[model samples]
Every structure is written in structure tokens, then in C-alpha cells.
Target chain A: MSTAKDTAGEDMPWDEVTPEAARKLLVAAVEAFAEQGYHATTTRDIAGRAGMSPAALYIHYKTKEELLHRISRIGHEKALEVLSGAAGIEGTPSERLAEAVSSFVRWHAGRHNTARVVQYELDALSDEHRTEIVELRRRSDAVVREILREGVESGEFDVPDVPGTTLAVLSLCIDVARWFNTQGRRTPDEVGALYADLVLRMVTAQK
Target chain B: MSTAKDTAGEDMPWDEVTPEAARKLLVAAVEAFAEQGYHATTTRDIAGRAGMSPAALYIHYKTKEELLHRISRIGHEKALEVLSGAAGIEGTPSERLAEAVSSFVRWHAGRHNTARVVQYELDALSDEHRTEIVELRRRSDAVVREILREGVESGEFDVPDVPGTTLAVLSLCIDVARWFNTQGRRTPDEVGALYADLVLRMVTAQK
Candidate 1:
């Protein structure tokens, strides 16, 4: 239920996707795909939502799939950026992991629409497109895995299965998009903090 | 990727949704909705998949939404049964919570196809139908919340926000349907065990 603008202010994700019309189409596509799902949406619906004709839609993206691909590519890149930024920060692995989860969860909750389409609509993409997106996702996973691995190495955390735990962390954050609502009781920040605390508990070593 | 038969054994969730023909249509509808989503799947497709005529579908259910509602209702009841069974077991709060998460997660992963349709297609239901389904979900939430409340009251758990943690635990388990693949490295049992361990860590008091 977040207005597109709610997620568009400073550090906006889609600012780099061009031209302006193409970005509009991409934004509209995200909205449509999130609301009705990828299989039920059409290129004409994206074009209409963007205040353009169907023909004009083709001028920027030839097919609805292309639009989805672009949106997915950009969205994944943003997600990777959020995780990589936290992973690279100068802090203990626990601190880094908390930051990574909190920020990643915030993005999913704040941009629930775009995150929903990016996280749930992978099957709608062509094989080639899906492969590219999956690669981006792998990098995101690696960032979290590295944090968990470092924590275990440093004896700062007690994760028994780093890979499985990494998947759970990412899966936990990604699903915030499915249930988050702008009108919900918890704000994005609140949920982010709560999840971060819970995640930290999952990894913290018992004294 | 699981076959319908894989989840239709002795403890099949839909056995109670008779008659035989109606159950077939419901199973077929779950497949169609899981594969193509609710908006994109037609009743004709459900009928064909069930080896029945369109008229047969009409005789059993007036509309596609009716099929979805029945599936949702039955699926939710099964989910509630899983959680409530775990909650009612004679064990410590920690043991019960672990049992609840493991079994609930197992159901979501082992029956991913039906779980996908039941969890994700709620938005497509009619308002009245959605409200009914939502009420069922509230009961599911209540079951989990009661367990967490007991854990907190018994001083066996370190939960700061019982209601919020309940949502996180339920959200984590429900999402297994979205990412769980039959061909994936982890089996339903393994994933359930891993998740149960992780969730236990999330609530156990630090020594």
C-alpha cells in the first residue's frame, strides 16, 4: 500500500533506470505485476498506467517480459547493494549481520510493491533473464553467508549450518514484502529492528 | 515439483473435502492456481486437469473463486490442525514451540503446491470469502501466540514481544512454500529440522 513516492525520496532505487519514459513504464509494470501478478498483467496495462499508448510502450521495451526483466535487474542490483554495503562496513560480524538484515528488511518493507514483483515473479521471466537475476541473488546470498562465516570463525556467533542459516535470514527478510502494509501497525523501521534483533538472537552464542 | 500423490497419502489434507469428484477438481484447481496463479487460471483449465467437462466444474462449484475458497478453507484448517496439535502436545514450552515450527514448516514444504495456492491467492478471493479466510488465519495466529505467551510466562523463553515474535515465526514458516523446491538439496524433513533449530535459538534464554 506504500505510494511509489514513499520509496522514491533520497536513495531511490530506480533513479538510474532510463530513459524517463522507460523508467515510468518500469515503475508502472512493478505496480501492476505486484497487484495482479506477472501472468495476469499485460504490456498495455503497463503502458496505460504510465500514461502512454501501447505503441509507445514498445518504443522503450519491446515486450512485457522485457519490462519485467529490467525491473528485476534493477531491483536485484539495489538489493545486492544494500547487503554488500552492510557486509563491507567496518564492524564485527554480528554488527554487520544486524545492519545487513535491518537495512535489507527495510528496503523490502518500504518498497513492498517492487520487492514483491522482484521476489515472487521470477518464474515469469525467460530462462536467460532468470539466470541473470539468479546470479545477482547469489551474490546477495554470498554477502550474508560471508557475514555468518566470519561470525563463526571469530567465535562471535554459534551458527551450526552457515549456509542454511544464511538462506533462512534472506528468506525471512524477503518475505516481509508479502505481509507488510503501509497501513499496518508496524512501520518499516520497527519491523526491521525487530527482525534484526531476532536474527541476532538466532546467531548469538550462549554464554 | 512434488507430485499430487506425494502429499495425498494417509494424512492427506483434502481427504475430508468430499465427494471424490469435488476433491479431484479441488486438487486440479490447486495445481492450476499454483502454476499459473489465480487470476490467470480458468475453471476450464481446472476441469480439463481433473478429466472433467466444464459443466462438471459448474456442478461442483459455481465459480473459480468458489474452488479457491474451498481450497483456502480446507488448507487453513489443515494448517491450524498442525499448529494446534503441536501446541496441545505434552511438553515444555520450548519443546512445543520447536514441534510447532517443525511440523508447520514441514507441511508448507512437503505440500508446497497446495500451500502456494492457499497462502498466495487470498487476495483474489471475494471480499466476504477473504474475510472468512482471514478469520481462519487469525485463529492460526492465536494458536501460535498462545504458545509464545506460555513460553514467556513460564520463563523458559526470552521473547520481548510475544505477538511480534509470533508473527515472525508464522511468517518464516509460511514462506517455505514460496522458495521450497522438491529438487532442492534439502528435503522437507531437513528444512523443518533446520528451521526448528533456528527458531529455538531465537527464543531460548541465553545461558
Candidate 2:
């Protein structure tokens, strides 16, 4: 679940995306969309990035929106997988929440280019696709909320509002993708550690 | 400093911008940029929205990029003013920090359409324009950092990483523009209050 190493290696986080050409198209589309945004990036530009012809792009995906939908779906699935992995880890709620936040932050920082497009370009997706993506986001919300709820029930966390705090926590972690820079002082691991510590501080029992 | 009422009435946050036609163009640009993104919004579209001819747009602003630069500059100034106002309030570090986050969050949520364009369309700015906006952003950061630094010095807050926490706090407030909806369950004031509480919890001294 650690995406830290993927930032510097050929072992990309998109390994699960099958059919090499389709994955290539998807990867190219992510770059195009990130750089030029969805409305300005043409299908031709995505095809050119993939070293394929526009005809070839059509062979795989019908429209640019489809490429974005695929990226959004796949990205959300990976995000959910990472959160669920940490949530199920054997530990106290504090430990679990820390793990959840650190791993989640790691993904957002390390894969920021792709994460930016996945998280920000939702308005460009077709309504049907967006509905599906929204459901996945709700699941992500549920995962974090459950952790806070468990901590509160166990008297380990002093959250006044579980749902509201959950949104704040998730929003804090998610915004990392918007500002994370490779040339910045902190590495992904450092940010993940700092954020996890801060998040734990947010929920720790006040005493 | 309270922007909570701006979401519902005629008193707009963009009143600082002038003349009436230029202000109309800026307002139109914000709407167009928010709905279709920076790269996709045409000069003609902006002029049309302002009920002006495309040639009239060129008369007021040399190019579309210039229009964006003006919006960004104004928006950043407003954000800095909001942060500075909260920072100067006579209170403890905790009170100042809470006010800063709550007011900052309110602006993002209340004036979200402009905030959305201001915060998200940054990459589309010319390098010089972006640099100017980035400098304004640094000032905003300094205000938050000073609050946290004072809190640490006063032993009222237990922040180990002032800069990192400042980034998280600002990022959390700024992202309200990304997801804030008028039709949503929580009003701008409610979100601002909730975020302020959560942020205080993040920095409050641990037992």
C-alpha cells in the first residue's frame, strides 16, 4: 500500500490497469488533463502523448470523457483500497487513523499529478460517471468516519462532531495533492508523518 | 470581515473591482472560468456574459490572461486582508487562529465561485502573473505561521511543525471553495465554525 517508492521507480501505481495500450492511453490522458485540463485537452493530444494515432485512441475509448471516467474510477478504487487497508490494520483507533492518514497522504503526495486530475476534474465527467465516482467518495468518507467513531466510542478521541471532523480530516489529507511539489523540502514520507501526527492531535482525548 | 451573508444577497465580495463594466467583465470571467475552466473559456464568452462585444473586452483588458491576472490579484488581496484582519484581533493565539480559519473558510465558501477560479485556475496565469499571486499567497502563509508561532511561544499550542501545520490549515480552508455548494446541508457559517473548532483541536496542547 506504500506509494512512496513509486514516485522514483518504473513500478507505477497503474499496474492494475490492463491492456498495455489502454493503460498507456489512460496514463497519457492523465498527463494531458493535468497539464491542459479536461476542456482544453483534445483526444488528439492524448493520442499523441501515448505515441498512438487518433484513430487508435478511438479504438480503445469512445471519448475524452471516457478516459477521464476510467481514470476517476481507477483512482478512486486505489484510494479506497489504501484507506481500507489501513483501517483494517491491527491496532487501536489512533494507530489505525494514523496509518490511514499517512498512507492516504502518501498516495496524494507521491502520485500528485494523477491525483490532481482525479480529484479536481469531477465536474467534467458525465453525470452518470460522476454519480458513480461520488458513491466511491462517500465510501472513502465512511471509512474515516468509522475510525473517528470507534475512537470516540472507546474514549480515546474527543470529537465533538464525528461527521464534521471526518470531513475536515479527509479534506486536510486530500488537499495535499493540490500543493505537493517534488522540489519541495519535505518528502512524501515526511508529509505523511507530519500530517498523521497532526491528525492524531486533532482527535486525541482532551483530558 | 464576515462574508456569511454574501452568499444570499446583492452585497457582493467583488465590489472592490471597478469600473462597472470592468467589474462586470471580471465577474463574468469568474463565472465562465469556474464553469468551463481557464483554458476553455473564450474571450468572446466572457464578453457575452458581461453583455459586451468581444472588442470591448480587448479595450478594457489587453488579453484574457490579463483579465485572469486582475482577478487573481484582487482575490489574493482579499484573502490576505481576511487573514490579516483575523490575526490582528485582540485575543489569545487560539482565538486569533480560530477566527482566522473561520473567516477564511467563510470567504472560500461564501464567495466560492470567485474563490474557485482564483484558487484553481492559477496554473493558467502567465509566469509573471503567477509569481505575483504566489507572493501574495506567501504573505497569507506568514499570517497563519505567526499565529501558530505565538501559540507555541505562549505554550498555549503544542505544534511541533509550524510551517507544515500552517500549510494544512490554509489548505483545509481553501479547499472549501472546491466542494462548497449553496444547496448543501451546511451553510458557509456552519462549515466555517466546524473547521475552526477542528483546527483548534489540531494545535491545542496535549495533556
Candidate 3:
């Protein structure tokens, strides 16, 4: 539920970096950040989880903030790519939008620990880093907005406020990280499929 | 936008805490908890925000956890009351559900800083306290579930899974706290109205 799962059935196209030690540190950092939150997590905790001395963390990442920046940048970049990938696939607007939501929701629910840290810990980033991340976030929004626009234009969906509905869809997906429990009855795929169907209902209003 | 204001257009039924000092401390705590999160925020920091000594905080509700408990309890209790109030009203199922979503979303948007802490920072509480708080949360879910069940039973709504739709509806409303910004375009009332319409579409599937 937390780390290192195959992207089968889900559309998580994240990469594992080279230099096994650094990847270990990054993975450890994600767990720490998810469990204790960004502000409360310490460099020592990350280092200890990675089986290294405190000073060892500085060799790869200068500060705890840098670790967060790296994780966020990569996470958001991959998330944007996932959205765009689904959006660009050959299909009707509804099909593409459903694909996007299914995969996007799956990523958030399946890899929710990393997603939780990525989504909620933006404030801990310095301004420069945050601006970069926010730009990625905006692009992610544009992907969804463009799909909604296409749906409306094609008469497949009847969204009155495309931008507002875009935000609502993304909000609904992002919140899976906050509330999705592995112990719960539904699997990530089940939740993702349900959300995809529900989102289509949101746009088309099928009774 | 973050603090006190008239609930004229917005249907926020929350009452401001009585006793000026307690209110001040609660407001300060909400700001601190919202900014730094519960684990990173200390009692001293919360007291300082209220312009009180560290010891002065003890005169008001004991430890930092107590402050969070008080805030969370009151907020959830009010939220439950809001939902049940709207549900208990004499109206069609759609009307009552819309009223519930509108007022509940309004409360979350208008008082989002407090809501952000109450919704997102639950893991910071002690085990005993969290158990108590979780019961309130279940009650909140029950209110919405009951309404959805009524809607489904009446053949007014087309939801296949009442429990799943209930979770989605609540998730949509709860996450307004995470994303709603005062500097953004819509007011709380507007957002509430929009969400009410959307929730109606979600249930009724009316274009």
C-alpha cells in the first residue's frame, strides 16, 4: 500500500532512481513524511530508516526541505504525465476522461502514502520550490479542464462550469490520499472504477 | 475570510465560542494548527498567538491535545447537527440532501482553517481521544448515509451503492476545506450553492 508496487491495473508510471542508496533514502523519507508529516519529520529519522548515519543524508540531499522538494517535484511531474497520457489516448471525450480519472484515482489510492505527503506537504517547500510545484499542479489542472471542455463541446457532457467541475473532480481524487484505508472493504481498483463512473455521472447527469 | 464574519448569506450555523479569552485562544490555536499542523504546533506557540503566557493556556482546557479535542469535538458536533437539522426538515429527499450539502459545505468553506485541522490532523490525537473523536465522525457519516438511503428508497435517486455514494458526497464536501481559498473567485455562499446543485445532479442525475 505504501511503496514499490507494480503499476499493473493502475497507471502509476513513476521511476525508481539509480544509486540504490539514494532511492532508499527517498523511499524512507516518503514513509517518514507520510507518517509524521513534513514539519515534524527529522533528517535523523530519514537517515535511520535508510540505515545510514545522520551525516549520510547530506551527501545526497542537502536539507530535509531538499528531500521534500525532490520527492514533490518527481511525484507531481509523474502525476502530470499520467493525466496527460490518459488525456491524449484515442477515445471519445468521456472515455478519455474516464480513463484519466480511473488511473489518477488508482494512483492516489494505491500509492496513497506517497501521494498523501506529496499532496498535503506543499507548504513545507520553500517559495522557489513551491512555485515550481504549483506550476506542475496548474498543468495537471489544464489537462482535466481541456478534457471537460472537449466533453462540453462534443455534447457528451453538460458541465456548466468547466473550471469549477475540474477543480471538484481533482479535489475528489486528491482526497483519496487522505481517507483511503487499505483495511477497508474496497480495493484501490474498486474505488477507482467507482469514481470513474461517478465522475461520468457528474458530467453527463445520467439518471 | 479566515476568521470571524457574519453568516448572512452563508448558511454556517456554527456559534462562536463564548468567553473572550477562550475564543481568542481557540482562534489562535486554529491558525497555528492550520499553519504548522497539530504535531508541529506547541501549546506555547498557541498561547503566544493569543498573546497569553504559556501558563495562561493551562487555565483554559489543559494541554495542547485538550485544545485540539475541544475544537474537534465542537466542530464535528456542529457539523453533525447541521446535517441532521437539514435532514429532519420537512422536504422531499432531494431538498433535504441539497440543504445538508449546502450548509455543510458552507461551514467547511467559511471556517476552513478550523476545518483543515479538524479533518486532516486527527492522527495527532492520543489513542483514547482519537477513539472518542472517531465515534463522532461515524455519527456524521450516519447522517448523510441515512439521507442517501431515504433518497434511494424513495426511487428519487438512482444511486446503486448508497454507502459508496455517501462516502463520495461527504468526501466532496469535506475537501473544500483543503482547497477553498478566500482570494479565489467564489464566496462561501456561492460555493455552497454550486455544491448543492452538483450534489443534486449527483443524486438525481438531472441535467
Candidate 4:
């Protein structure tokens, strides 16, 4: 970790990576994995995309799985930040939940190329890495579940099942990565807005 | 189609593949594709799994892509049947919508391996085949959207965005294939019931 700072500024701590070159390689890996699934993509392909020799890829990522780990870790962190940011905002539960869904969905749609690789390729991770990533996902789920619990408690929402709805909401947002296309009629913002209103209807008390 | 019945008694169209040998190859392909992915799973591996020679495999399916197409086609046809059946049921729009989600989610959870390969591996299909599957998917979406429209007209629901909610609802159910595991705490029935209620909440006037 110190070596990274000794050579380059300490912007982040991944698998002890975040250098500009490492970051470029990681982005290339994400594109390769997204375009042609994790198992199908080769290290040679990733290195080739980044315009780096195959040997240079190993200087940063020990293996292709490591590259996937870094991408998934970063993606989950962004997802958590988006959800928790909305959940922590100063607003009613309905407002906050809408904010959470809209922003989270927006990220999934806008960064769908990376999100697709991160969200869909969990099975490709090593057992230990997958466990760690699952922990991150569990926490992400908790963020939304807590919002639903509060909504139910405040009598602001009529949710019959908090955990169930939480799963549905997260599933709903994650799926935008699977289907959203840049050329499609709905832009990320439109989808985000549409989901926010639909989610509000899912929870808010009837007038 | 008649060839199927001439050789083997036609009990069912898709879920029931004709002859024992053909069924084994399809099941083997589903497992291989799910485990290693469509792009990585070789025809030899699929044939090996089915305990057949590679030459024998071609008699039933022309290529690995054809196997994927068959699995995807049958899976989607079944999905359409479930949604259309639920929509055609005698009930309120809310009841029908709930039934549709419940059954769809149940299939995704119970047959998660096949569902995972089918729903997630669309990009691997040939363009002509994918277009056909997309048509099936479009019809499936229309089933749900039609129900939502009926709910709005009947004043049974208060959705501000019918088309948007339809997309969210399908996305919510399809994602069950991604996260659900039979060995996990929840059973297919449990998930189906939970989604049914949550979906009702999404559409119906909040009570």
C-alpha cells in the first residue's frame, strides 16, 4: 500500500491497485467481461484492449479473477453509496426511498456496461472473494430494507412485507443493467424518474 | 412438428422433448451453459455430459448455438404461457397481476439453472433467433401491461405510469432467477407468495 503512494498518489486501496495504468487495465477488463462474459474473456484480450503487453497486466492484477474482484468491489461500493446517500438524506421516508431508487437505477442504466459485468458475473468469483462480495451485497440490501422498515413504522407506507419488497426493489434496479440500452427510447433519467414514481406507489399509504 | 409425434407420442410440446436421447442432450446443454456460460461451453463438452459422441449430437441439434436457441426458445415459450394464462384467468386485475408475478417468479426460482441460462444468455443467440425470442418477450410484456391498463380503467389501481410499471414488474420477477437458490432459506412457494403480494402493492390502490 505504501509503495503505491511512494510511486503515485494514494487515491484508493483496491487489491493494492488504483494507479492510472492499473485503472486503465481494469476498465479494459470491464469492457471485455461485459461484452463477452467473464469466462469467455482472456487476459490477452484485456491487455490488448488497454494497449498494454500481456506481461504488464500481471504487474497490477495477479489474475483475471482479481480484475473481476476489483471491478465488482468498486461497483458494489458505488451501489451502496448511491443507496445509502439517498437513505440518509433529510426527507420523509417516501421521498428518501424514491431518491434511493431513482439514483440507484440511474447508475445501473448509465454505467450499464460496467454494471453488467459486476452484477451478472458473481459466479465467476473465487469462493472467498464471492463471500466478501456477498457481504457487501447483503449490506446494500439492508440499506433499502431499513428504509422500508421505517416507512412501515412511520405509517407513511402500507408495505405488508418489508424484506420481500426490499428484494423486489433491489432486483428491479439491478435488472436495468441487463436490459437497458443507450439507443433505447428511455434515457437513464427517464427510467430513474419512472421507477421512483412506481416505487412510491408500491409503498405510500392510500389517500 | 409432426415428425415429433410420428416417432414419439407427443405428450407436450417443449417441456417434453421427444425421445430420451434428445432430452438428455438439452438438459446437458443447460447445465454446461449455466456452469461455464454459452460462449465457453463447447459442443464436445455438452455431448460428453449427455454421454454421446459428438457426431451423435449433430443428429439432434446442428450446433451449440442451436442448443442454446432451443433451450431459450422453450424457456421463453413457457414464460409466455404462464403470463398469458394468469392474465386470462377469471379475477380482478389485481388478482390476475398477482397471479402472473407469483407464477412467473416461481418458475424462475424453481428452474433457476435453466432460467439463468435462458434469461442471462440472450446475447449469445444468433440475431435471427434473438429477434424471435424478443418477439416472445414483447408479447409477455404486453400481457402484464394489458392487465395494468385494465386495473387503471377499473379504478382498482392507481398507477401513474402503466408502461413503466409493466417494465418494473417483469424486471422484478425475472431477477428472481439471478438471486434465488433452492437451498437458500426461501422456497419457490414462499417467494411466489411474497412477490404476489408485493406486486399487488405495486399496482393496487394502497389500502
Give fnat of each prediction, in order: 0.70, 0.80, 0.48, 0.87
Clashing pairs in 3: none
Stretches of candidate 2 above 4 Å error? Answer: A1-11, B1-11
C-alpha root-mean-square deviation, each candidate: 2.8, 2.8, 3.6, 6.0
Distance from true location, Cα of B207 in model 2, Å: 4.6
Candidate 4 lDDT over A1-207, as tens digits, reads: 323321112122334346878977887787788777899889999999989999999998889999999899988988898889988999989889999999999988877877888888898999999999999999999999998889889999988878878888888899998888777889888999998887887788776
lDDT of 4 by residue, B1-207 (tens): 323321112112344676778887987888888887888788899999989999989999998899999999999998899889878899999888888998998878867777888888898899999999999999999999999999999999888888888888998889998888655778888999988877787788745
True-structure Cα RMSD, model 1: 2.8
For candidate 2, give the DockQ.
0.79
Q: Model 3, A1-207: lDDT tens per residue?
A: 224453222223334554677777887888888877888788999999989998888888899999999889988987788789988999999999999998888878877877888988898899999999999999999999999999888888899998889998999889988888877888888988899988888888343
Assess the local accuracy of residue B34 in candidate 2 as a C-alpha lDDT between 0 and 100.
77
TM-score of each: 0.95, 0.94, 0.91, 0.90
TM-score of chain B of 3: 0.89
lDDT of 1 by residue, B131-176 (tens): 9989999998998888888888888898998888989999999999
In candidate 1, which residue ranges exceed 4 Å CA deviation? A1-13, B1-13
Calculate DockQ per candidate and list them: 0.79, 0.79, 0.57, 0.64
- Identify the runs in model 3 with alpha carbons over 4 angstroms from their true place: A1-15, A205-207, B1-19, B205-207
